[model samples]
Target: MKKNFKLLMLAVFVAAASCSFTTKSFEDPDKDKLLIDLITYVLEKGHYDAKQFDDSFSEAVYKDFINNVDPIKRYFLASDIAEFEQYKTSIDDQLLAKELDFFNLVYSRLDQRIKEAQTYYPEILDKPFDFSVSEEINVDYENLPYASNKKELKDRWRKQLKYTTLSTYYDNIEDNLFKIENEEDYTPKTKAQLEADARETTLNSFNDNYSFVNDLERNDYFAVFLNSVVTQFDPHTNYFAPPDRDRFDLQMSGRLEGIGARLQKQSDYIKVVEVISGGPAWRGEHIEVGDVILKVRQEDETDPTSIVGMRVDDAVKLIKGPKGTQVTLTIKRVDGTIEEETITRDVVEIGETYAKSAIIEKEDRKFGLINLPAFYFTMQDYEERNAAADVKKEILELKQQGMEGLVLDLRNNGGGSLRTAVDIAGLFIKEGPVVQVASNGKRKEVLSDRDSEIVWDGPLVILVNDASASASEILAAAMQDYKRAVIIGSKQTYGKGTVQNLLDLNQWLRNNDMGDMGALKLTTQKYYRVNGGSTQLEGVKSDVVMPGRYAYLDIGEKEYDNPLPYDKITPANYSPYDGYIDYESTIKRSNERMAKSAELKLIEENAKWIKQRQDENVVSLNLEAYTQAIKDREQYAKRFDVLEDYQSGLNFKSLPKELGLIEIDSTLGQNRQRWHKNLRSDIYVEEAVSVLEDLKLNNIRQGSLAKIKD
Candidate 1:
């Protein structure tokens, strides 16, 4: 099944084989123009459902590029938009002609506007906001119009800045009051002082944003323009710059050669958000979340470059290097102590990206729950470590620990390797056609598990949500089609039927002097279920629908712009699993139980409340009205607070093997403890386990638990 995914890639390679791209000299020396030419060529030659470069396409690119540059209409004026509208229907022609006139004009104009806009925020925050004035700001930015003139634009910035500073101002007052009562010899600040502090904080944030914006190079904006052009083909299709491609590779492999500390830019400092377990940062205990990285110095360099006010990307470049290299970081600890720490970079594996399992005990029965965060795998070696293999190992371990049933949690799993999805699906059924993939003008290929061995044939439950997509959908749809598992969670999974192949653009060049050309994630094919249904826009429907936070929200692939149309192909020859006595009855029982579940009803109510809050975007600028509105919402929200405290009463613990590992690695132990605790309180997991309990095995699959216990 894994090899078949490679064959699909082979087909993509073959489709573009005729192009015979090489490092041939181009008359156009501009890299941006060259990229446009190369990208458009690949799109036309390789995209599964390629679009024509017509006036309509040009119009789409124009609109999307403008939106990409200034989404909130805060930068560009009405006159600027009117000027941009002239080339709205000419972008497609420019793409084909390898011209960057439109992109150049917009980029230069945006640069000028941003520099001018910088003067406005600091001036606006200079004077204290009149919070007593009865005013409101509609934050539906998409529908909002550009400012008609400079005065209107500044006014727009005023309302937005006031709205932003208002919350902080109120918080300052509340915090000061609390400190006055609680702390000994507390210095109390007046409302005016608090307002000034709030304005300063807002001003600092603006400065940080402008600092980042200023750090952006022309190549960065070109990447945005490239993506705006490529994504017009489909949402999944994208152009990744060199750095972004590296990140994509790291994400797919879940391994990177670095110190393994996830950093975020806050105000001016690059703050450590998470120190990945088993990495140098975690091992040395020199860095922790909330520590601010002040400077980075390589072992080869005598001087340390101060990272204050630098973009996080640039700071990261300074920190990350070849494995075995050393980098010293000047850190300001959470406790306010400044120190220098040197760390040797190494290949850090992100444990969270892999499959993790927990055994749940309910009324003396054991059930296996494997949470597959993503269908991760090594890019170079498929057998090294992967989601499917790890899951199989976990299942076997759970079986050793007397697991009678299994719950494969695909919630928030945005999908990864297609091969792993096929292999994972094979673990349940003996052998069958798992999914059917189709490319343009090619025969449909059915990716099946050729192996006849059934790893776990007992009762099964698949937990999913709107975030479960691509490979996740493939697995869930396969199991559902086979009637081998009861699908639980959201009303439907994330509808991402299309498959993307990451093509390194540098491969097309030979004897090339140009630096890394980055990569293109092109949508190459669309996959369908064995039952012939496409999960494109209509993702896999849950056997037992449950209310979720996204229930009332427009989410998933259906919400994406320019998504591929949903269509079905001829069904693959397959038979449903006969292990279930009555699969329909099992689903019905779960549905009835869910219908009566008070916890689920409460969750549904909370979801509706969240949706209502999201819909109410207009906010009052008056401090008193805003504070009252927040208090009123919080007062109404108190009923939903019990949802967080709800416990399934199920006992979740790591298997014996993991328990041993946990004993040595306290971080892993803590993470597992937190996960198990969350599982215990998770209403969805509780319901999934309940469904597992209801799923009975036929005699053919009976005594499997007994065999496992043996």
Candidate 2:
């Protein structure tokens, strides 16, 4: 998935960079302009599909940049937009000349508008909102025009704030009334007090947004602007600031020294979104999802620094540190109780991010189920522990435990390493092409599994969903092409065929001192199935299609504005797997069951309901109407809850190695237990297991199959 700076690409830049960029003495020492020149040069020479920097490209950058800065039409009035419209089609010309006129103007105007809006919020929150007023704030902001003037902007702020406060006000009233009715000696707060509390919450949220925005430096906004330009080529192509690049590396590595709780800034508080399994937070058993982190303190600190209204990035920097350190966090529990917990930071392996196996015991049959979250690998060392290596180990271990069939769960697996994906495919098939990679004006490179060792020559089923992308698609497509595995789950996987190479921009400069120049995740190649079909816009379709929530969602590569088009090249010279006796019949059997299942019917209904709800964007502002709507939704949604409670009657157990680890690591046990419980309720997994049972191997041994060597 990652490549070193291409030698030819480097050669193209080195001479010019060394001559023009080596000298620190310049007429204008503007790093932004320098970065623009460097990035544009790289894109021109190195990108897989370099787009023209013409009027159309300029117009896209203009619209995207404006949206990226002020998405909700809250800031930058009509006059400001009108003033900036002149450069809409001239941005390409400016970039070619390395001129920052348009960028500088917009940045200055946005800064001034942000300052002005900061003043507007506190003034607006000072007054109480009347919930009786039947007024609706249309949240369809993309279609809505910018405010005509200051008066209109102020009214927009007021209506938006009122809309936000309404929900909290209703909740406050409900909670108070419930307590008054249930508790014998409970005294309810006045309606005015409830209203005041709701206003305070809204005020805190507004302040938080401003505080986070205020923390942004010119470089941060510049990164956004750079992305707005680069992403014009494709959605995956992005400009990562230094901090952002570091974060991306951490996510890919799946190992971090921290409390290991994923935090997001919600209102004024840092809320725990997920407690990584086997990490300190999960082991501690105190911090949980929905718990708000109020303050963070290092081991040697005298006073805890209040993290309220702090940026999530800054808060994370405080919370995470080197291994064997201690950080105490003041947590506001979901139940509204306050508690302080001190946790020792360790080298936490995010267990969820790696390949984990569960043994499915069905009527004296032991089936292997390995859930791979990503095709992760060590960026520096491919030989180090990686997803493919881990999965092979899991497969071997499962075989040791009397495993007859396997189900590779790749649901919600936004892919990582490409090499690992090919390696994983090699596990299923003998020496053959896994995926074909093609750069613009270059011959297709057939990345094949050279190793003739078939790890698991058994009935295999792969479960994928809309979130399963890139490497996930490659592996699934390869297996599906070879008829080595029966792919199940969503109608199609996430169509993201492009391969990106994370290029360090600093590497392009010689003897330069502009600080960290950050990195660019550039799309260098497009990958295709071994069948020569690209999964660019059209993702790999499942063998036995199952209903999913994302079946109706616009989250695929095709929905993206400027995605690479789908095409086919000459198919790789590889023969299909002759291992399965009745692959088509097995698929047909699964489809027949899928059509009749009550659980699947309910799931489809739920997905439709979700799409219906997603379409209903217009919301009422009146308290009575809003509360009634909420109640109605809740009452209607009660039927869908049966889908969650539906049991597949399948027993899921851990392998022998994990069983021993579970005795010592209770957190691991708890994580597995929760996963198994969810799997039991999963109709998709149940179908996959059923398909695995139905699939009968032909046993036409590996070396015997006729292969067309290229």
Question: At residue 123, what lDDT does model 1 achieve?
Answer: 92
Identify the leading candidate in terms of lDDT: 1
The regions of model 2 sitting more than 4 angstroms off are 1-29, 257-346, 699-710
For each candidate in the order shown, give its overall lDDT on alpha carbons: 0.84, 0.84
- Compose the digit string of candidate 1's lDDT tens values, residues 450-503: 887678888899999989999999999999999999999898988999999999
lDDT (tens digit, per residue) of candidate 2 on 1-710: 11112121112112112111111222233687889999999999999999999999999999988877776777889999999999999999999999988888898998898788888878988988888978887766667799999999989888777877888899899999999999989888999999999999878766655555665656566677888899998889998877678767777878778998888776667999988877888877869899999999999998999989776777888899988999999989999999999999997787777899999988888898999998888776778768999999999999998999999999989999999999999988878899999988478899999988788888999999998999999999999999999999888888999999999999988978677778899999999898889998789899998969657756678777788888899899999988888899999999999999887888888888877776665778899999999999999999988987888888999888888888987778888999999999888888888888898877555335333211
> Residue pairs in steric clash, candidate 2?
none
- Model 1's C-alpha root-mean-square deviation from the true structure amounts to 7.1
Mark the 10 consecutive residues where model 1 has the least summed lDDT: 1-10
What is the lDDT for 353 in model 2? 77
User: After TM-score superposition, what is the CA distance of residue 688 in candidate 2 from its true location, in Å?
Assistant: 0.9
Cα RMSD of all models vs. native, in order, equals: 7.1, 7.9
Clashes of 1: 0
